[model samples]
Target: MVEVRMRVNGAVRSLEVEPRVSLLDALRDHLGLTGTKKGCNQGACGACTVLVDGERINSCLALAVQYAGREVVTIEGVAADGQAHPLQEAFIRNDGFQCGYCTSGQICSAIGMLAEHRAGVPSAVTEHLAADVELSAAEIRERMSGNLCRCGAYNGIVESIQDVAS
Candidate 1:
């Protein structure tokens, strides 16, 4: 077992875990933060997505030991004060989820996506490389492609993201 210390949801969490354990397992099993779902553990589904240092990453693909000293934010972290994050409220107001299995990951991914866009990051759909990228519907859809909603909630998801982005 190796000792790993990471700030999770604004709290310091230290634990000894197997080097091979994924951050997803550590968070759910060790810390009891089960909001981050474990879907398609191969990292394709994005259901285990979490914010590592404010960037969205598949927790299933990241080793717990590798996250030492980093900040990890699960779905539980987004609304630390009990009042929902804007994205969360937007998701609810927009009905961005159906079965709700992928809701947490979608929300987390959207938060990171918005941050990236605000930081002038361009998606593949960006029309021009040099010009400021517009958060067009296509751009939002392209940027959020990594997160799939099996329940066919894409419309609502995109709408919620757009509402928050605006």
Candidate 2:
């Protein structure tokens, strides 16, 4: 087992996990952060999405040891002092979920996507590479395509993201 230390939700955590252990397992099993769901257990589904160094990643595809010394944020970390994050509130206000299996991952991915847009990162639908890309529905959908909601809440999800983005 390799000892890995990471800052999760503003708290530093240290745990011993096998090198082959996924970050999702390390967080859920070792650290007891179950908000990040394990869906697909592969990189295709974004159910295990989390923020590492403020960037969204599929926790199931990332090795826990690979994130040593990095800042990792799970769904639990998105809120502050029991108050839900604005995006999370937006999700609720817009009915961004149904079965709720993908809500956490969606919220986390949206958070990171917003950050990327804020930093002027362009999506496939972005028109000009030099200018700040305005987040149209197409852009949002394209950027969030990695995550799939089996409950078919795309409309509400897009609306929630648009609400928060605007």
Candidate 2, which ten residues in sequence have the lowest lDDT sum?
A: 126-135
How many residue pairs of model 2 clash at the backbone? 0
Task: Give the per-residue lDDT of model 2 (tens digit) for 72-134.
Answer: 999999999889899999989999999999999999999999998887788888775543445
Report model 2's TM-score to 2 decimal places: 0.96
Expressed as tens digits, the lDDT of each residue in 44-133 for candidate 1 is: 999999999999999999999999999999999998567999999999999999999999999999999988888777789776543344
The residue ranges of model 1 lying beyond 4 angstroms of the native Cα positions read 128-134
lDDT of 2 at 109: 98
- State, as a TM-score between 0 and 1, how close model 1 is to the true structure: 0.95
lDDT of 2: 0.93
TM-score of each: 0.95, 0.96
Off by over 4 Å in 2: 129-133
